[model samples]
Target: MNEALQLLKKYWNHDNFRGLQAEIIDSVVSQKDTFAQLPTGGGKSICYQIPALLQDGITLVISPLVSLIKDQVENLQKKEIKAIGLTGGISSDEVSNLLDNCLYGNYKLLYLSPERLQSDWILERLKNLPIHLIAVDEAHCISQWGNDFRPAYLKIANLKTHFPKVPILALTASATPRVKKDILEILKIENAVVFEKSFDRDNIAYMVFEVEDKLFRMVQILRKNPEPSIVYVRNRKSCIEISRQLQQSGISATYYHGGLSSNEKNKNMTLWTSEKVQVIVATNAFGMGIDKGNVKTVIHIQLPDSMESYYQEAGRCGRNGQKAFAVLLNSASDYIQAESQFLAVLPDKEFLTKVYKKLNSYFQIGYGEGIDESFTFNVNEFCAQYQFPTLKTFNAIQFLDRQGIVTLSHEFSQKIIVQFLISSKEVIRYMSLNPQQEETIVTILRNYPGIYEIPAHLNLVLISKKANSTQEAVLQILEQLQKKEIISYRANGNDSTIIFNEVREDERTINRVSKFLLIQNDLKTKQLESVLKYVSTKNECKSRLILNYFGEQKKENCGICSYCITLKSKATPAIAVSKQIISALEDTSLDSRSLEKITGQPSDQVIFALQELLEYKVIEILSNNQYRLRK
Candidate 1:
């Protein structure tokens, strides 16, 4: 413990370990398989990171997201610690070189994706290295029941087979009981030591408001809590729009999204982190690597896809042990919008089967063949030939990727992004003048939402299908429209690559995994419904509801949430409140609403106080239902 504490102070400059971090570290250091479930901001990384620093040999870390891996590697390198990350799109030569360095170099941490384990050579190379510990970040992804399940994560169990002597440490921000079981079982960790911290934040007040104008409500909230704040939105367009609106109302705000270049992201982040900007309006992508703790408020203009996301996002604030707020705003239309965004885009079993077969046909792969065969996938051409919807078809391909049927990799250097520079009416007039281009122009406007507000990646094949033309024709029309300054377009070479991990009996392959697919989609629906219920429910304490969802039943209601504050105010007999209400009516006859404001008590408490006076015959009700002291 002394040595671990010393290393932590040297590298991270922390005086001591927090919460279960030290216990989890001790377990891992003793070479015991450990599953640690801590909520966001719980210092889960320190549990394994400190052990990695104290261990004799290099530690192997498997994480899900490339961005997360990159950030961790850079942070380690900043501390002058030797660390390396093997992310996707790297040449085999580079991977071989990095592995060689890990074998000989004084590297303490080596981070890579779970998909890398698919290569037998990589596994063989890893077996030769002196791996001290195996840490799996976002361990919940290994579970089929988890919110962000990835089949690639299931392959992490293979590392246990290879490194028979080393310990495995799994960490996640949130996980239900079912997900926890799946992780331990899938990882094949026998006699696992599990450390779970309560998923409760007492300092933050959870609030939900139903309003017709979310923007106006947001403005009011910002004004009320004029401390550092974050407003979460769902799309890039909303990020820009909300920030601009906030600025117009004299609130210093900035916006961040994935579409922004690295420079823009850094600038905006710097503005907010430096306290120069009071608020940051952003999509979900804005939260990675954020360590600011003074954020007094977190307001979500759009609901997240699941409770896991909601809890993580809402947990971002109140880390400084100060009172903070997590606000969620909803309108009547958000329910419909949520369904369309989540359910409509989900690819069903039949659609998934069709996508798999078409993919096999497009790649010219025969049944019982094509394992380990990789090909550059031209998504536009395939979608055109099949006349499939771009959004759902892409989702189906991704589902296959997750199920290990194929590996779908993207090369961001090449993409067809477009945004219309002119209004639809002006474009309609232009299209009528040049009727040859009408179909292509109309198709782009319809398929791509937010094309007018933000640049969107377009599936050229889908556009061609809608226009009843060829990809070449569509590209030509796009170029012509760009030349006329009607739209902005950017494109490069191929977009994605697909490698078949299984033999190409497409329908049978999909059928084999259909049950998992069904369960996952159903879970998505249930998760969304849970969030919907949490917001709509007025009687239950919001904090207790969240804790229950995470499989922790709190004995007492959190006294600060929107529900508890009212419930607590009314739970006691408001004798003083009754006297106050009576005194307010003594000067003149007054209605319940006026007494409410005059007494400065909650509506329920004030009404109960008035009722007590009426029942005791100490007050009289006028014909207009106004309360008056007994005459």
Candidate 2:
């Protein structure tokens, strides 16, 4: 224990470990697989990060969010620790170099998205690294029954066979009893040490306001609070519109969504974290892995997909132990919108097959032509070309994934650069000889660096800033260079990776898969219903309800809940006034009317006489040129 504390103090600036951090670390040190169900703000990262630093070899953290992996790697690097991240958008050569560094270099941590586990190269390379521990972030995603399951997560259980000696640490902010069991069984952890933290925040005042004008209500809350707050909306358009509205009202605010450039997201997040922006209005994409400690409020503008997601997002507030608020403003249509989103993603076999065929045609691929052939795709253009609904087409793609026909992954826009191999004057002379293609080649050669090295990664923001141009213009110039064969540029694109298994369709096989997909959809709908229940619950303490949902039992109700306030109000009644007190006010301005109103006793004779006189002087007169109480 003392040694663990020393590591905690040495690595991080903390004197002691909070909640189950010590126990979680001890379990890893003792070579026991562990499962931890810590609530938000419970320091789950420290549980794995600290042990990874103290362990014998590298710790591989499998996370679902690629953006989160990138952030974590950067943070670890800032701490003077060697960390490598394996995610899409990096070149294949960069991945090989990174994996080589992890295997041979002194890297303590390696973060990878679950999708990377499917790569054949990754599996081959894993056998060479001296792995000490496996940390699964958001482990609940491994369970098909869980709210946020991914098929890639299911493949993680095979790690036990690859590295039998290393201990595993599974972490999640929210998971039900069933999901908990599923995670444990799927991971094949035997008698894993369990650490569950209570989900209660007495400092947060949970209020549900039934409102029609959600945007106005949100603005009112921000105006009154005047603290760091987050407004969660349902869609990307809402994030943009609400953020604009808040700015128009003179509040320091910004919007965040998955659609924005990575640089834009980083800039907005920095502004909010540095307190330059008082509020951030965003979709669900905004809050994961954000570790700001001074957020005073989390206001939900629409119904979230699940209670787990809502609690995690809402828990971002009041981390500094100050008073904060979590308010949910809802209307009738929000429930319908949420329900429709769930249903739309679950398609029948016929619809799925048709969508798949249409997608192939849209991409201009036939039979076996597209196998292992990668190309940039424009979703809007593809949809227009195929004459299909974008939303429905997207949902159909997800369903096809469940059928195991193809694997889908989101892509990000990244820049590329090359180092100068020849003199700039020589290149210009060469361009003069071949003007048609040489001009484009010279343009790119002068623009980017490290490109001479194969599959080099470049910072698009820095490049654009240096070029004094928009990203669109930079991409157009790159495209022209690619066309001239002076440079080969992979256009930065937004499309899911489609790996076709190309299974021959059988009606029975399709039916079985479609039925399974529908069942999963029904389960998702039930999860959303659970979120609605949390919002509508009025008879229980909000804190107690949340705690109990996460499998914690509290002995008493939090005295600060709306339910407790209602009970207190019911037990106490308005006081009566005493007549003797009314008679004593000899110099008061009241004439006959006050004298008659005060002298008559209603109930509890002594109380009524005193109350009537006080009410008459302070309350009644104040309303119609009333008397003021001097402090």
Candidate 3:
């Protein structure tokens, strides 16, 4: 234990561990099937990484997010610890080399996405490696009820059969009691040591404000707290608008969404992580698997679909144990709009069938022709080509993925530009001749290490930014050096994998499949509604409510939620007014426009207040946008 602690301090620059990290580490070292329910920023990675180093063989980490695998593997490598990742964006040769390293090298960790488990070759390769432990990140994904549920994760249980002696560690930030049970059953982890930390962050100030004009409210928030922050919205278009607003306000800001190319996403992420950009306006897809520790705030301009997602995204703030803020700016229309959007995206059978056929056709596979081939997909292109709307199309694809009809890989690809362009021999000779620029040349060589591998067709934006040079300047140098036969550079692009099942089985045998997908979509919608409930609830400690939802019992009021704070501020007559409003509605069916006249409150305030009441079930919604009291 002391030896591990020393390594922790020596490599991670931490003298003391946070939360239940040390305890979790002990469980892993003891070779127990451990379950860790740590909140975001609780240092979950170290729990397994440390024990993996102490064990005699490599620790196999199964993760759903490829971005997370890249992050963990890179962080480990930076600490001088050997680790490798088998994810998308690599060639078969690379996978072969990585597997060889895992077998022959003293690598402590081998990170792989759960989707890779379907590959028989991968399974066969793993059987020969000396794997000591299996760590499943985002363990909640194994459960059908989880917010980020993935069918591929369910197959991970078969690992026990392959490596019976290896202990398994399941970890997640959020999971309901049902999800917890499902995870244990699906992973077949018996006699597991479970350790969960309190889901409270004293340093994070949570606030929600009522806004009529969302853009105006966002401007105010950015003007007031202009530190490193994230602004989350529902659509890709909003990502652009919000970012433009921030830039107009003189804040260094950028936007990220699925619509952007992988190079753009990586550049934006890099700027945000390096503090080069003060704000990032992005969709929910931007934050998962991100590990930036200095983010001072996270603002939700639009609501997320599930409490699990909101909690995870909001938890990104204050990771460094410093004071931070998370705010939700919402209006009456925002709620209605979000709900309607959710309903609109529910796929019909026709739509699903069309997409299934289109997917097979998209990959040039006829009926059963596309059984196992994987290809990169662009949602916008697919939608445009097939005339499918974005939201419904995305929903349909997600349904297919959940039903094991396909596998989707989400990854960001970037372009690399060379700092000093020169040929191998000429560059060596130039360095040999010009000792003055030798250090600069060497740094450039080390940074653009892959220049020799794929010289042409590379994205030079990132490398240009890293080199502190203009893209043209970097290119000019590369061209000159290449002309001198010292080096070479080029441009390239690649797509993310979204693989489809090729076999067109008999419809009768697979009737359960489409029904199962429909059920999954409905449940996902419900999860999003639950998320809305958490954000809008004013009757319980927000943190405690979140913890309880994640299977944690014995948790008390956080004393920091809006409910507790409002109690301290004294319950105002607003409650009484709300009660009277509910009563009046029960007596007579009325719209907000009519209710406002009787309530004598302004339209926007009355509408906002009424929506809150409706969400709390204080008033039951009736026909034609009318409302009635529950009693």
Candidate 4:
């Protein structure tokens, strides 16, 4: 523990650990398998990283996302730690060299995605390396019951057979009781020490607003807060549109999604992180492994599919322990749309079989073939070719991936990169002929150390600033350089990827998992239904509800949430009438006159209650003007 503390101060420059970090670190350092459930910003990395530094060999970290791996590796490198991240984009030769370096070099940490474990060569290399500890980030993904279950995570269990002596450390931000059990069982950890930090974020005040104009409400919230904020939307189009709208309204904002190039993503992230941008409107892809501690607000423009996702995302705010807000702008239509978009298109067994066969045909794969083969997938084109509904087709693919029949990766965008093909003397001679390109080339060379050796991710914004030119002008100069054979440039491109994990026995493969697939669909439907319930329930404590969903029993209400605040607001006769109407309609439907007679209230009060209920979708008005509970 003393060595661990000294190492922490040396690398992270922190004097102490936060929450359960110290306990988890002590357990791992003592060579015991440990499981940690910490909230966002709970400093989970240090629990394993400090131990890795204290030990002699390297720490093998299995992460689920490439962005996360890249971020951690970059941070570690900035601290002068020898760390390497093995991603899918790297060539086989690069992987070999990286593995060799880990074996022979004094590397402290090596991060790799779970999918890479499928390679026999990689596994053989791992067997030869001196592994001190194994850390699994986002450990909940190993559970089939988890929200973001990846089939590849199941392969992580094989590590027990290979490195039986190495201690294991598993970590996640959100997990239910069942997920925790599954994580331990799937990882084959026996009698592991479990450290659970409180899931409650007392500094963040949760608020759900039922609104008609979501954008208007969002603008109002932003104006009131006037701090670093993140607005989470449903789709890429919405991310762009909402960001533009915010910018038009004189707010410094940017948009981010999986479709953006790596350079663009980094640029936008830098703008937000450096406080150059006041707000970031993004899809769900924006926030993982992001360490912005002073985010004052996190607004969800659309309800997420499950409580796990919503909790994890909203927890991103207030990491610095100051007061912050987690607001959900919702409408009745949002609920309907969420249900239709996620629940309605759940593919059945027959549909799954058809999609499977079509997918194999699309890839020109024969029966009992295509195992471990991956291809660039265009969902729109495949749906168009088959005359199928795009949403249903996507859902079918997702189901297949979840069932381990296939592995579907998110849309990957190649980095915008440039490499100089000419020598320094050639560049100088060309610059003398074309003075307009001189500034851009000079700026690139000054900013990048080895552009001539390999293609490097170039920042057009920075270059434009340094070269005293517009971004368009900088891009044009790079294009000219490419045309003149002075440089090689590659623009960003977007495409989803799919790997067939099994052979192409369409029905036989899918039929075996059809029942399990239906169970998964049912679970998803229930999860979404829970979200709807969270939004529609008017008087319950918001914090308690979310905590209870994660299996935390809390009797006290968080007095800061919107629900508690509204409860403290001056109550009127109409509010009491509305509650009465909701209670009355909970069990059976009743017309206005019947409700009025049962409650012994005036007709006017009954009318007001009915109107309020109808507006909030708490009760639906039937054809005969009778009222019933919605859903």
The best candidate by lDDT is 4
In order, candidate lDDTs are: 0.85, 0.72, 0.75, 0.85
Task: Identify the runs in model 3 with alpha carbons over 4 angstroms from their true place.
Answer: 78-80, 88-100, 250-252, 258-267, 270-277, 292-294, 348-350, 371-376, 402-405, 410-497, 500-512, 552-559, 570-631
The full ranking of all candidates by lDDT, starting with the best, is 4, 1, 3, 2
Q: Where's the lowest-lDDT run of ten residues in candidate 3?
A: 412-421
Task: Give TM per candidate.
Answer: 0.74, 0.74, 0.75, 0.79
Worst 10 residues of 4 by lDDT: 407-416
Q: List the residue pairs that clash in candidate 1.
A: none
How much does candidate 2 score in TM-score?
0.74
lDDT of 1 by residue, 1-631 (tens): 9999999899889898888999999999999999999888888778877888887898899987777888889888999899999866676789999999999998899998887887789989999888999999999989878976887787889888888889999999999998999899999985799999888999999987665457766887899999999999987789999999999998999999866645467889999999998999988888877878898999998878899999999999998989999999886578898988888889888999988888888888899998778787767778999999876787788788777677676532246889899997898899889998888887888888689999999887678888899876887888888999999988866656777777788667888888888888898999999988898787899999999999999989889987887765535458989878877877899976677678777555666677678889999878796879998
- For 244-275, candidate 2 gives per-residue lDDT tens digits of 88999888899888767665787888899889
Task: Give the count of colliding residue pairs in each prediction.
Answer: 0, 22, 19, 0
Model 3, 1-631: lDDT tens per residue? 7988898888888888888998999988887899999887677888898898787999999987766787778878898899999864455578878899889998889998776787788899999999999999999889878766777788899998998888999999887778888888888885689887766677776766655556665666677777789988888788898789778878789989865665577788999888898899888778656778888889997777777777778888888888787777776577788777887788877778778777777767765455556776777788999888988988888777655567665553434444334447877888788665455456566665766665444445655666666555665665656676565444333334686543654353146466656667788778777767776776677666666666565455656555566667643366665865876776677766567668876444565677779789877767686777777
lDDT of 4 by residue, 245-300 (tens): 99988888998997776667878999999999999998888777787889999999
| Candidate 4, superposed: residue stretches over 4 Å from native | 86-98, 118-125, 363-376, 399-434, 438-474, 478-492, 497-505, 508-516, 575-610, 613-631
lDDT, model 3, position 629: 71
Model 3 alpha-carbon miss at residue 497, Å: 4.3
